[model samples]
Target: MQNSPKKEFRNDEALLDIQDRPTFFHWLILSIQHLFTMFGATVLVPLLIGINPSIALFSSGVGTLTYILCTKAKIPAYLGSSFAFVTTMQALMKADGYPAVAQGAISAGLVYVVVSLVISRFGSNWVDRVLPPVVVGPIIIVIGLSLATTAASDAMLNNNHYDLKYFAVAIFTLLITIIFNLYLKGFPSMIPVLLGIICGYLLAVMVGIVDLQSVAAAKWFSLPAFDVMFVNYHFKWYPAAIIGMAPIAFVTMTEHMGHIMVLNKLTKRNFFKDPGLHRTLFGDGLSSVIAGFVGGPPTTSYGENIGVLAMTKVHSVWVLGGAALFAIIFSFVGKISALIHSIPTPVIGGISFLLFGMIASNGLRILVDNHVNYELKRNLVITSVILVIGIGGAYLQLGHFQLTSIALATVFGIILNLILPQKARSEK
Candidate 1:
């Protein structure tokens, strides 16, 4: 249960370690910073998928708390709505409504739980063998690239017609986000997406595109819409929806590993060995299960909040817990939810432009970081097939079940990786 020795900070020392308790004032400020860091991306998922943003906020708060408790308050990580499931959720919502989406998400969570149990009994080595960088990197790429058309459509079109005004707003927002990300310093630099949205909203307001009626009519305090599972809708399992969604758990699990590695480097604690991957995965799975039941998207560990930890050098779990509390509090404020809902399509599209591209880039980064040799025919063939199938919109349908896009690509990539022959040392 003990972690490895802490690595010494080379430059400025960490202001707060994982176990360090910050004073009330410092804790509040630090916690609020983490909240802001996660807010933009967290809410964006539910917004795009036509769900109540407030519920997403509430679910994320609860999910983070669950993760913290499950990890023994040792790892300072925040869970938020995952982007990996966005396109799948959107399609499911369109085809079978939110109930199908909820069932799919719950099924995905169960997949995580089962995998965690197996890892607890055996080990995580099988994870790498089944989902090596060669397979995983392209799957991640497909997730982002497959969403490209959606981002573009939202950015440039209004009701299926290309609108110059909407396109202009999208471009402006994209520029603002890029500038803030590249040139800003310290805390402000960490929240380029939030800043970009705020600026975009103001521009929309000026152009008379944003309607204020909903925000004005919203109450100051109210409960988020919990129209999920057995709340407002009957629970029904769709095999098609489960097939489309459950495999995504594997992709996000790899992402979870990456985030854990990043935190280990930044905080100098061996979380994988201490709290253990099994515990973290279980927490994430349980959180998503709760989110599905309560009407929200699947949750995963956020890299944005991790950036805050690396920047401020504050790794206190208490600070993250406080942030979770803030998110929960924000969700009940009716005006806030209304305001988030009022965000124009162009603004969301603009943010997605950058965010989705960054996701694809991270996929490339995995390949680069792992040094997956493209010179090998096996590597080339796997990568090429995944890209073509994923981006070309190839799918398999049987009766009521269907597999398409990222999910299909992921399955193909894994099978290919398992069967492909490895190059010998002499081949080099």
Candidate 2:
């Protein structure tokens, strides 16, 4: 009798075979691309919530490095600033009535630590069994839809009437990104995000929207004003942070599993069976916790870098390590970073359109993976209600801490999914 077929791989080692690494040039090229992919995201957290960019960069670089080390560089992924925590941090600051919310935000990092421990000990599957698709999906959808304010503002930058140039830039940049990511080819296929930004920057320059004088004035080397770890504790802020940011991890946890599955498919090895998913997730959670401590924002599993791997077909971990090293170097060179910061608004907006939309799509993807059919009365009601309430700002106040429509909806979905009968799945 024929033996059961063994999974074929690109190499016998696939990802595990890191003994033969990418050449220096290969590392350099991949690092450059990785930097571009992660660059905007790293700076994005601080930029949105009024934190120092330099420190954010430094923290992101360090956090990403930590994740790489924890995972033993088994996965070819890039960790970036997570937007999920931005609102939580802002809410913490406002709720605390503190000078800066960074202190309480620091405390929130401990939540990630606790979560990592749970995942590492018991396993990551429970995260989903508890959160479920109904809850995690809609909450993710709301997070994306909630960005409409900024998305619209980005499009406004393209037009001067009422100075909506910001919004216009965003729309234009987004369009280019979609076209490239979905259709463009050759070198353009790999760096679609970068290309969109370049095009938008040029357009903005044509319209005199760019201010290079600031970039020119920025020194070659200088520490960012606020780029260190400091802790602040507000009991009220802690709960808000946990409620708002923790639920989002439900989606990311699944994403981490999916990524590991993909890496398994690519390498033809079961990662979870050996070094393990729990270990990787522990790294992911710790990476975010570290970033928050240094005011960098939360870190998350990145699908974009995965796309790069698919495009380039280069499975060398050295490339990922190279990217981190480059980011560390850039953290100190104020001038080079200043140039990156000089890129125009429209480009960012354009890229954000696709990036943000893809994020929303990921949430929906989770539901699809679960075969989430709304035929069941419970599923139908929970899903429909969540969509409307979260998108419509269905929120509740819990004393000093206000629960966002998304967070409230998340909790409600979890409870409903728990009690709901799965018998309906077989009905149709």
Candidate 3:
């Protein structure tokens, strides 16, 4: 596959295209910006599932590098621990332990591999037919909106109770981010999210919300709690575990497509056509397999990083690579990891407030850019159903597996689009 040519932009533009390379200083800061953006969600998945957060950080870095290599550095995306598998993985961890969960992760990766092979053989035409703009737009919207509650909960609530300090910190951080994004020039303009996070963190520190005890207790350096498949844990195939986890791959795959579509719209380049969806899928799948072997949670394209890309207009794969490196390095440095972990929830919530809104706005941009005729009842139905199902906490359960939120909405949207007549009665 040929690499896309680097697009030139003026210094005043402050835009870093996919193939563009920033200066060393700019690169480091930009990369750190992404690190801050993805750290919370990536580590949260493992923490929620009772796994080692450091391992997730390490695997996320490795997984991102794998994805970069597989996509030939053409797609500026980062892979991080996926939240979609949290419930199933938690159950697997309880029932069959980490071994079964690892096997299940590998099984899920294989499902992506299988799907990628099919797409490679048959091309992605069917994918287009299955997920048109009408369906994809709202799915993207749902993906962002679905996370709204999480953001709000983090910003406004502490242990499910209202916290004035958290609310103030969150609002203050968000305002700082907005001001930077709107009024800054050149380099500062591109890093509003990072700046907001820093200022918010300081505010959190002043408010006594920042806990540094963990950092003080942490060692300077340490190895991640690795659980190598063959070395640390014996490989065991549990059909029930595989059955429980494998189907979730389909769910994440749809989310992956939505992320890719978001990137396409943001970058104005068709990555699916360039690096080929097959390559992207292979990278993502292989990353998950590697994560499984190493005891990290399953990895997928991260929307937080995507939101940073959108906000900063920095799409350099090199910058993303640098973030991956930091993740790996942080995984080994106990104090550093502890310090990052100590960042108050409100700070993260504050950053997410802007980032998630950017994602939702991009979805709206898709609808507008594609000129989707909302006047048509067919289009209206597809969009409406996706939004309701995706944001309303709707879910579908089959035996041991459950499909919920954005994934369920995507499936329903696709089905509705296919069944509904293309030409429908328009509103008067």
Candidate 4:
């Protein structure tokens, strides 16, 4: 339960191990920090898809707890609303309705359960052999780069012309984040993203850009609305929805691995080797299913939470438990949810710019750390193909099902790796 001797302490003199549980006050403070780190991105899934934010928050808390239990309290991750299902869910809802989309997510979660069982029975060697650093690195890069346009759009606020106001807020936030990360020390340095957000939010208010009228009118307490549940809708068991949703799970599983890899690096713990990939994947899938049943968006490990782990150096499962509890409590408080939604887009844009870039950088770091040789022809081919197909928006459509760039790259890399022969010198 304690930290490994190989743990990299942020401060050489002050080491905080996983087992070195903090006081109640300290735990609360750290947990609140985790809350802020995840809150900005977690609610966006429901916000974009026109679902109740309270339900998303509540489900995220429950989902995270479910993951923790499934992993035997070993993995420190917060499962929240996934962005992967955004477009597909929208299309399904428009075509078939919300009930159909919910059914699709449930089907996808079932697919994860099957994949997890396979890994659990046969072990992760098959996965590692097929999707090693060479393959996983570019896939992770694609996960971040694919979202580049969305990040830029949020920051720029204009596709054709420059909007100096929003752009300046983004830059200001970015600058403060850099300063907090590099120049500052102690607590402030650990929560640079949170600090940057506070600064940007204040600036946004000064410029008269923030709108808090909704917060002012919102009730103090409210329950989640479950009117869109699959059971509530007529004919929710459409075969087409299940067919379309099941394949999306394959893509998400790849992203799940990347998230686990990043967590491994951040905490200096080989979670895949410890709790094992089978358990982690099972937990993730179960969380997704749990979210779907509650009328929330499908859940996945939050990359923003991983970023928080990397920055804060606080790797305690109890802290995550506290965050989950806070989320659950906040879900019932209508005003709190409104306040979270009121945070201007520019602030989120500025923070996401740094957070998403860090994710891509970590992917590259994985390559270097693992000694993935670019000199080998097979390696070069694998890397180039994955990066291009993943970032280029290439799609593999089968009937109504489709695999996006990351999923395609993962499949292609595994196939290419297994088939390509190892050669020496010039041939390599």
Better of 2 and 3 by TM-score: 3
Residues 122-180 of candidate 2: C-alpha lDDT, one tens digit per residue: 77555547656666666566555655555555556445454666656666777766677
**lDDT of candidates 1 onward, in order:** 0.80, 0.62, 0.89, 0.79
Q: Evaluated with TM-score, which candidate comes out highest?
A: 3
lDDT by residue (tens digit), candidate 4, 84-169? 78877877778876677678777888888998899888888766687788887887777778767766777778545667888888
Worst 10 residues of 2 by lDDT: 1-10
Clash tally for model 2: 25
When sorted by lDDT, best at the front, the candidate numbers are 3, 1, 4, 2
Candidate 1: Cα lDDT at 403 = 62
TM-score of each model, in listed order:
0.74, 0.71, 0.96, 0.90
Task: Give the C-alpha lDDT of model 3.
Answer: 0.89
For model 1, residues 260-362, the per-residue Cα lDDT tens digits are 7657656666676777889999999999999999999999998666655654567778889999998999899888767766788888788778766765666
- Candidate 1: regions farther than 4 A off: 1-53, 72-108, 225-275, 292-323, 398-404, 424-428
Candidate 3: residue 58 Cα off by (Å)? 0.3
Which candidate leads in lDDT?
3
Give each model's clash number. Answer: 0, 25, 0, 1
lDDT of 1 at 155: 91
The list of candidate 2 runs beyond 4 A from truth reads 1-34, 37-41, 47-50, 74-77, 81-106, 131-144, 157-168, 225-281, 292-322, 363-370, 396-402, 423-428
Off by over 4 Å in 4: 1-20, 158-162, 227-236
